[model samples]
Target: MVTNKNKIPALRDRKAALLAFMPAFLMAAASAYVPMEAGLVLPVLGFTIMAVFFGLVVLWWQTETERQTLAMQLAGLEQEERVPTAPLVLRPPVIVGSPLSVLRELAVSASAQEVGAEIVLAPTERVQPARFPEPSLLPSMRRSSAEEVSRMRLVTQAFEADRIELHLQPVVSLPQGKIRFYEALARLRLADETLLSPSEFLPILECSGRASDFDRRVLIRSMAIARHLVARGSEAIVSVNLTAHSIAEPGFLWSLAGLFDTSPDLLGKIVLEMTQHSWRHLDADHRAALATLRERGVPFSLDRAADLRFDPEALADLGVRFMKLPADLLISVAEQSDGRYAGPELDVRDFASALRRQGIRLIAERVEEDEMVPKLCDLGVPLAQGFVFAAPRPIKPEIAGEQTASRPFGLEDAPTLLRRAG
Candidate 1:
């Protein structure tokens, strides 16, 4: 019995208000209705009928307004995406002292307490040299060498009592065509102010049954560094080297999940650099853990590919997308093999071609010669790391940006530009 004029205005006002609540109402309605429908509930049927009728009316009205708003936003977004970006032009490379080299020096010069102070300082002033005083040469010379050694031993013991420390070298990657920074490596610092290379300490840790502790330290520290780098707008990855003992540990997989449960953003950026040393000891549970990591976008890479124990084809099968070859392997293969158009068999070109066919990226490590540069290009190695390229430096925000911007566009510029860009 309502008049048309009165009914129309009331309907319009109700429709607009209903549209404001539509999405949440519709979601709740659908959720309730689905379970009710499955259970065949009479009350659910009545509620769902009312919900559908109301939701449809609100949706029809809202669609018109939303369509217009979305159309305008889409047009703006499309325009932004379509705008051409300028290629990153490079300037002459800057010379920065290596972060790893500095740490090595600090390890030799400072007590563990001083090392902790320096690491705290690293985030703020990474490029600046540590301010620790050099060892007193004249006084030490005047003392019996044994006395100087005893004094140093006492100082180290005192520092170790406090248990403050820094561990792990950050592995950084040169930006390749589609890839950003590859991965990070872990370096351990000891109580005696000695820096232990993974190759040295890792095996001992495994044999001494302390691999799990070492792995935990590496993972936590590497993740902390990765989070710091990401906070600075760099999208570099941190690769942690895991030992067989650590990977094979019960609940290790669940521990990883818990580690990343709060920071899912780190999942894809964490690359597991699994070595032959780790691979040989992996069990079914470990393989399952690796599978889980792969499913979560945490890719794996085979390290030290020159070690004949590693099977490239097997790694490819296990979904490892990258492999690192030692400098000596490239040199040896290039010198020995007979391949197409070879003075020396172009190891980078030949090896890369083979690996590419198998869907793997070949990374040549310790590449330190201008003469070796052309061969790498011809070999089409996607990544090259060495002193000739930039030596391992601290992953500073500005330097990280520069590295990303200078990446080569294709294999055409792979040699000269890759080294220069690095």
Candidate 2:
């Protein structure tokens, strides 16, 4: 019975093999049906072709399986080793063993001292004792935490006090550094006249869940700036950076829409910007909010992208009109692979062309060095922003602080200062 079962399996395999070659057999027979010698040659050629095709397919399948297995193993290792390095208060203390060991050690020492026994216990194997953070270190840590909280409080107070400042950095055209756009940056002015950049206060705002408030303020200021530029007969657009937290907030779109209703011209003059991290982590609600804003004629711009891996079609569908990449990053990537390799499945050289096809413009930012200009131009990047051209300059407090302008901005009033920001 066992032999019959094994023979049945071999018969099934032979049947499948014959079925697979049936088309080739029929073709060979049809090619030379009259002479058996000629028919033999046709069959031999057909069988050889079929064998090579199947062999190549099998080899591809095997190699693909190996590649996938290795990739999965590597991913698993990376995930296992990954650590959180943000918001120090949230990070757990580094302890080799259970935290309870410290308490247990203290209890054992107390009991041993109470017993008044001078017994020396011999250790078979040398082992390190449990280490705990020092008492003095605790006060320093507390002070740091208190300072962080104080800074966060100061930022919150700044929002309430209307002490937020709006600064604009020019995003100019390549080859000719003509200003085309101004990226709106927020600064916090404390009571002591110290100006805190977004880098210093934004993290505090986000951690305190006040990012939405900040975004709203920046949007309002950016809209005013855009209007000012337009009223002066300048065709410059103002891009305002928004956080995901703001978009995800309830009634965020409603508020934004209301703001847009007040100034309809902002539709063409204002551009909404966000970091790549915020864009990737957006949920359905956040996307819906963005979609509502997009429907209202607000365009989006992606900034601070970690890599050059961008899907032009997808970004356009999401209403992304501009993408900003660092000039150094763009140059390094192009130099490394001759502009062929961009992330896993993109070409750096072809990226601008692809984006342009989708009505998206690439803006190379952080252009600190003058040498980066020709390289950026060669890469087909049309727009560039950084300290190489002009640092972020304040947009005159009277103009930015009020809806009505004191006077129109002239050529000198433009943020064209050639010096780097201090």
Candidate 3:
């Protein structure tokens, strides 16, 4: 039976060889007949047919030999012993204590060393327990009462203390541009005559629920400074920050109208920076109050416009004329690609474009790097503010009028002077 199977494979190979030669045999026949019918020389036709027929037979034999060699190789592989593979070994994970436990152990060790020795307790001496002083009868320590007390204390002290002062930071225009405005930042002059930045105290004011009162005081002082600047033939706009509570107050619009009435000229020069967070807090009624102010020609700018959550569309609907984007946003974009602010790098491009379509001006706040100016300008941001442009400083007439006129505003100027005033 094995011999019969081998013979069957050999017969199959021979059949395949014959099939492969059939095309060559057909070509030889056509060549022989065509030459014979044309009455060509007998010897030439016979030699040509013979050469073709033999060439095909040789090709068929070579193919069959290759097939047989491959079959032998495959049969040998089938009979070969297989190599066993090694089993995979998985190592146990290392155990480690939590950071908090490690810290606690270290703290205990440190405390034990610092204490030097443990104390041995002796028998306690018998003595009468001293009567505690009667708890002072006062208002309960509820959040509302505590807040009211804190607010009263802050207002009282602020009014009594002469430390609170208004510091003006000049916000200069672009290259060879005029001094358009100065932002009025609140400064606290400590008892030592050292200046404390608004950042340190502004949070305390907000936490104490006294932001509105603080805003009122700042507005009053800033207006006084605005009047002073206007009297000097300076048409610089004075910008003031308003808290969300102040914006929501029903009488705030009226209060602003009264301020404008006192300093009529200040109306044209006053710019209120309504922060994105503050604007979000305003309900329908509060927004109506804002609309009333808008009708009165008080210009408003949306601060931190780069905040993704800040509704640019809504702010535009509210007639917001100016928007301030963070400086880092512009700077990072410029640094990444050929100092050009475009594509994904300019994330607020869509918002800026939307606002620009409505004729609103985009202001890039904190434009510290010099390289960023061209890119910002390219991005259609006409106004740039940062230490790179001009540091917030106490408004000196010469510095405000002349320094701004002579040197291009730079970020380097901000740290030296901004620390002095802001």
Among all candidates shown, the one with the greatest lDDT: 2
Instruction: Please tell me which predicted candidate would have the highest TM-score against the true structure.
Output: 2
Off by over 4 Å in 1: 1-179, 190-192, 250-254, 307-314, 339-350, 357-359, 393-422
lDDT of 1 by residue, 1-422 (tens): 11232233223446566665565477566776565455656555566667667766665655555555557778999999998654333222232234454556545445544333322333454353333222210112243466534434332332223221333232323343243554454433333334334554444445445667766655666677667768889777776666655665577766786677667878767777776555655657777777777777676777755343344576676768777777556655556546323343233436676777777777777777756656666556667666665555434423222111221223222211111111
For lDDT, candidate 1 versus 3, the one ahead is: 3
RMSD of each: 31.1, 25.9, 23.3
Taken over the whole model, the C-alpha lDDT of each candidate is 0.54, 0.71, 0.59
> Which window of ten consecutive residues has the lowest lDDT sum in model 2?
1-10
The digit string of per-residue lDDT tens for model 3 on 1-422 reads 11222454333355655765665567667765664544556765576667667757755655666677678778878777453333332222222224454456556655655645343334583434332211221122345565555434443344335345665655655554455677777665433234667665555555455667778777877777777777788777788888655565467756776666676666757788887766665656767766767777777888855444454566767867777778677556545545435433325445457677776667777777787777766666666677776676664433222111222223222222113334
Q: Candidate 2, residues 36-140: lDDT per residue as tens digits?
A: 575587667767688657745544544555556567778988987795332212112234233365566656556655555344435664444434432311222
lDDT score of residue 121 within candidate 2:
38
Q: How many collisions per candidate? A: 7, 0, 6
Off by over 4 Å in 2: 1-144, 338-343, 402-421
Consecutive 10-residue window with the lowest summed lDDT within model 1 = 413-422
Runs of candidate 3 with Cα error greater than 4 angstroms are 1-159, 248-250, 306-313, 333-353, 395-422
Rank by TM-score, descending? 2, 3, 1
